[model samples]
Target: MPLSLAYAADFPSFADTVFILPAGTTELPINAAADLPEPVRAYVASQLAADEKLISINQYTHHHYYVVAEAKKTADLTAEALRKAGNKLHALLKTDKIPELFINDLTPDGALALAEGIALSAYQFEGYKTDEKSKKTPDLQLITLVGPQLSTEKVQELDGVLQGVYLARDLVNMPYSHLNATQLANRMQAAGDDAGFQTEILDFVRIEALRMGGLLAVNQGSPEPPTFTIMEYKPEGATNEKPYVLVGKGVVFDTGGLSLKPTPNSMDLMKCDMAGAAVVTGVLTALAKNKVKLHVIGLVPATDNRPGGPALAPSDVITMYSGLTVEVMNTDAEGRLILADALAFAKKYNPELVLDYATLTGSAVRAIGTEGIVYMGTAEEQTMLELKQSGNRTHERLVEFPMWDEYDDHIKSSVADLSNMGKAEAGAISAGKFLERFIEGCPWVHFDIAGPAFLTAPDSYRGKGGTGSAVRLTYDFLKRKATV
Candidate 1:
C-alpha cells in the first residue's frame, strides 16, 4: 500500500477526504452527513436519478441506504453527534482504498478521539493470498488532521485506544491455522506488557489442578494444551466497590467434539471463536493504557472442541468448577459449559458486576442476524439503559432479551444433574438462562453475540471477516461509568 500527501484549499491538502455538503442538502445528521468527493457525489446523484424513470428528490445521495432524512438531521448537533456520523461515513465511503474520514470539527478532543477509535476499528487483514478477488480490501489507513489545539498528548491517547482496537481485530481475524492455546496466551502476554496490565497464562498443569472441567474436556479432544488467561487491571485511586469481571469462552476452534457440526465454513476462520476473549482483552488494554482508575478482571477459558482419542462424549458426565455435574447431552453445546465454570469462578471475587459474552448458540444467529449483540442482564434497568445508549453510540448494537425461569425445565436431566442443551426451540434463551444460573445473584449481564460476531455480508465499520463486536459498546459503557 503506497502512501502520499495532497493539498486541498477547497478542503485542505492535509484532509484525505473532505466533509461535504451536497447541493440543496439540508438537515443536521447526528449520525451521518451530506458529504462526498466530486466523482462519488456525481455517482450517487446519477444512481438516485436513473435511466427511464428517475426518482424525484430535490437532493440525492448514495444508494447504500434509502437516503434517509434522519441522517441529515444528525450532523449539526454536538461533537458526539458529529463523531458518530463520522463513524458511518468511515465505513460506507470506501473506494479502491480503505475509507478514512478526517473531520474538521475543531471539536473537543474527546469526540475526535472517539472518531479515531472508529477508523481504527475499520481495519482488515487480507495479507494471505486467496482466490476471492473481491475479498481483498483497501489499505486506507490513518485519519490525520491539522488543528492548532490538537495536542500531542491527545493524539497519543487516541492512538493507544485505536491500537488496542486493531490488536483485538488482528487476534479475531487471524485464522486458527496459525493460532492455538499457547499462541493465544502469547498474544495476550504481549498486549498485557504493552498496555501496563498483568497477564498470567496458566498452563495445562495449573488448569488441571484447578479442575476447569469444561475447558479441559474441550481440550482433551485436541493435542493442543489449554490456557486459562487471567488479566488484572488495577489503577490508581480505584474504589473498593466490586470490580467488573468479564468472561470469554475461548474455544480456539470448535469442531463440535463427538457431535460434529454439519459441513459449514470452518477452514480458516474458526480462530474467531475466541472473539469474546479478544474483546475483553482489548478493553483491559485500553483501561490499562489510559490508567483508568478502576478495577477490571478478565477471565478467558481457552481450548478447542475436537474429536480425538480422549474426547468426552454425549453420554459422559463431567464436574464443572462450580461443583455441579453436567451431562454432556451434546458436545456442540460446549460454550455454555465452559462459560458456566468461569462465571462461577468470577463469583469468588464478590464483584459488583459480571458480564460474560460468547458465540454461544446458532439460534441467536437466527434471532438477531449479524448486526446486534443479544443482551440479558439482572433487574438493573439503569445499567441496561446505559449499555443500550452506549451501544447506539459505539455501533455495537445491544438488544435486551428475556431470561426467565420458564426454560429451566428443559435442562432437567435423567442421567445427570442437568443436560448441556435443552429442547432446540429457545436455544438462545436457554443459553442465557444457563449462564444466569452461575452468576447466582450478582448483577450479571450475558451477551450472546452468535448473530453479530461474524458477518456473511459487509456492514458498517466492517468488512468480510471477524467484526470486532462488543469491544466498543462495553468499553464505552465502562468509560461512561468511570469518567462521566
Candidate 2:
C-alpha cells in the first residue's frame, strides 16, 4: 500500500490513512472522519462525495461501499483517499487470494492511486520462459467516477498517465521478437485511438522527406523500418490552456550500431530503449483516457540503434529539423541525435512547456543510483522544487542538476554545428545539453530516467519491474498547474 494516505486508526504501520477500497460494499464511516481538517473536508466534499458518492468507510477488511450524497469532487482529496484506501486494501489482501477487483466513484487522487495500483500490478513480461509455471497477480479492475460535475479532474488526469505507463512498461517487458519498429508503431497508433487521441506513424518515405536524420540513420542498421509517431490530445471544452508537449526517444533497441556495447548484459535491457516514447505516449493516453481539459502533444522518435548495412557511422554528419548539423561523435549517442530532430520538430507549436525523457546515459545511474530521475533544466530551474513537492504528493521522484554554461563547452563540436556527444566528464549533463540545443525559447525540462524506470527488486508499493517513475510526478505537476 502507498503510505501517503495511511493513518493510524486502521493501519498502524502507516501513519496516514492512505489505502484502497474494494468493490460493492455499503458506505461506512471512517474512524476519524469527523475530525478531518478543514482543507481535507473541502477536499473530500469537493473531490469525494460526503455520503452520496463514496461512503467515507471506516477501516474494514475487504469492505467497499459508496454513499448517495449529491456533491462535487476535488483533486486533493481524491489523491489522498486513494492512498489511504490503498494501504487498507493491501493489508486486506495479505495472505489472502489477490482479488481481481475494480473500483468506481473516486475523486482525483483516489483515482490516481487506483490507476497506480493498476499499473503497478499489471506488470508481466514473461518473455523467455521455457516452462510456463504461473501463479496469480492481484486481479484488480477500476471503474472511476468522472462526469461534467462532482468528479475529480486530477484523478482523471493521473489515470491517463498511468495508462501510458502501463503501455510503455508492457512494451518493454514484452519479448522483442513480438515487437519490432512497425509493430511498435501499430501499437502506438492503437493506444492513441483507444485513449481518445490522434496517432500518426510517419513511414520511411515521410521520415526521409522530413529529414529525420537521427531516427532514420539509426534504423539504417536494423532490418525494421523507423517510425516517428505523433499523438495529439485536444479536449473539446479546454481553452486558454497552453498545450503540454512531450518528446520521447524511442530507440526500440540500441545495439550501439557499429560501436556495440560490451558485457553479456549489454543487450539485456535493449528492449527498454523505447521507454522515453512509452512515457509520453502513456502520458497522452492518460490525458485522453481521463478526458482531461488540457491540450497535450506527444512526439515519439522511435527507431532501433542497431548496426545495419546503411546505419550511421562513428563520424557521420547529419542535419536536424532545427537546421543544425551534428557530428556523430559516437553512434551510441543516437538517442540525443533523434531527440534533437524531434525537439526541433515540436517547436512549430511553440508549446508553453516542452519536456523530454530518454534513457540517455549510464552516468545518470551513477549519479542518483536507481530510484530517481536525473533532471536537467534551465538556469532558473523550477522542476526541482516541483519534483520535491510531487515526491511528497505522488511519490515518484527526480533530482535536478545544474545546466550551467560551464557545461556548454563540453558539447562544442569540432565538425558540423555540434556533436551528438561530448567529453566523458559529465555524460548526463552533456546529454542534457545536447537536448537543450533542440528546445529553444520555451520552458523546458529534460528527464534522464537512466535509472529507476525499472527495478531489480520490489519495495514499498512498487514491484520487481518497471516502476512507471515519472507518470505520477508529471500528473502532480499537471494537477498543481491545473488547480492554480
Candidate 3:
C-alpha cells in the first residue's frame, strides 16, 4: 500500500505520541503528555491556545528528540476521527520528516481508525514517473501503537484489508492501454495465486461458445478480445453451502461505443470504469488471505467499449446468457450487459446472494455526487440491513432505492424481452430493474457505485484516482456474514 504498518511488543518510551483531548476540557491529560519535555509541552499548549485542530512539536535532547501532537477533544474516538488523526500524522511524516512516530493512549477502535487513516492516505500513483528516486515521497515505514488496548491480531487483519484496497486502487489507476481485458484476467490469476484462491479465465472462444451475447455484443468494437474471470475461495467447514457471488463490470475503458463520450475530462477518466472489477479482485484477495470461514466467488466480465468496426448500435437486439433478448437502446449502457451474463451464469452455483458492482450511470452520479453509493436490490430485508450496516462501518455509505415492479415497466420493449435503456426518470433504479430480470431464483443486489468509485478531486484519505469504493464495505459485510 501507500505505507506499511509496524507493531512493537512494547515501546516503553517514544518521543512521538498523539495527545487526544476530549471536546471541552483543555487541561493536560494525566497521561504521557505529563512526561513530555517542558518546551514541547509549552509549544503544544501555545498551539492549543491558537485553536489548532492538531499541533506537532519536536524538542531535541542530548541523545534523541521528542515529537508530540496536541489534538482537540473528541468524546468518543470514532473510526472517521481516527482516520483523520492518521491523516494528520501522515502529513506530518511527509512534510516534517519525523522519522519515528508512536500512537499513545488510544482505545482499540481509536488506534484502528488512526491506522486506517494513515494507510489509506499514503497512496501515490508514481508508477510511470521517470525521476522515481528523486521524486519519491518519504514514507512512514514504521508505526508503533503504544497502549494496552492495541490488538496485534486486529492490526494484522487491517493490514491485509489495506493491501486489498491498495491493489484495487492500483488497478483502477492504471491506464487502459496497460490494463486490457486479457491483462485484467491475468492479474486476477496472479492475485489468486498469491492470495490462495482459484481463478479461471474464459477467453473469447469460450465466451462465444457459452453464448454470452451481452459480453460479446459490448466487445464487438474492440480488437482486444473479451475475457470473463471467475475467482473462488471455498474451504472445508465453510459457513454456507452456497457461495456469495460477486459480479464486477470490467470495462477497462468506456469510450461509450457508438454513442461516444464527450471529449477531454469526460471520456479521459474512463479508465476507472473497471473499478467494480478491481474491488471484487481486492475483496477476494483479502478474504482468502484472512482465511475467513465463508465460501465466495467473484466474476469479472472484462472488455473495452469503443466505436471500432462492428460496434454495437442503438436498438441492437442481443440474447443474454439467460436467453432473454435485450434491445440495446443505448450502446453506452454496456456494463449491465456483461453483468447480466455473469448474473445469469451465477445461477449455476444457486448462490445465496448475487451482488454486482458497476460505475453504471451518470444519473446515479447526478443523484448523489461523490457522497454515497446508489444501491437497489431484491434481496431480503435482513440481508440488505446487514449490508447497510457494513457500508456505514466502512464509510462506504449506501443510498438505497426502491425496486418496485413499476420500475421494471420502464425497460419493457416491443420485440425484445427488455431494453437496456429505460425512461429518463429514475435511471439508476431502472438499470437495477433491468438486471433483476436475469436473476430468476436467487436474492440479488445491484450496486450503482458510479458516484463514489472515482473522484475528480481527493476526499480525505481517499486519493484523487480510484477510491476502491466497495472493497471495505463488502469485506466487512462478508466478515459479519461469516460469523452469523
Candidate order (lDDT): 3, 1, 2
- After superposition, candidate 3 runs with Cα above 4 Å error: 12-15, 19-25, 46-51, 61-77
**lDDT score for residue 305 of model 3:** 97
1 against 2, candidate with superior TM-score: 1
- Which whole-number lDDT from 0 to 100 does residue 406 have in model 1? 80
Best by lDDT: 3
Across 1-484, the per-residue lDDT of candidate 1 in tens digits comes to 3211211123333334433222233332332224444554465456534421112112232222222112233333233334444455544545324444343432333335335434643566655776786576555555554344565455555555556666677777777767787888888988899898888999999988988787788777898898988888888787637788989878788888889876666524466788888888888887787677778999998888889988989879998887788888898888998898889889998987898889888788788888688888784898889888888776677878887778888787897777888886888888887777777878899988777776667654555567667876777788766774
**TM-score of every candidate:** 0.80, 0.76, 0.93
RMSD (Å) of each candidate, 1 decimal: 6.6, 9.2, 2.8
Clashes of each: 14, 44, 2
* After superposition, candidate 2 runs with Cα above 4 Å error: 1-94, 98-161, 379-384
**At residue 152, what lDDT does model 3 achieve?**
72
Best-matching candidate per TM-score: 3
lDDT of 3 at 184: 92
Q: Tens-digit lDDT track for model 2 on 1-484? A: 2111111112222122322333232332354244455565555555343233333432334433332322226444345445444444554444333333334332322434543544454445444555545533343333333222223444444455655666767776654687777788888889877988888889889999998777777888888888888888887876436777888888887888888977466777777777787778777776677666778888887778787687788888888877788888788888898888888888888677888888889999999888678887762446557756785566566677888888888888778888878787899998898888888787788889878776667654556566566776776676565555
Residue range with the least summed lDDT across 10 consecutive positions in model 3: 61-70
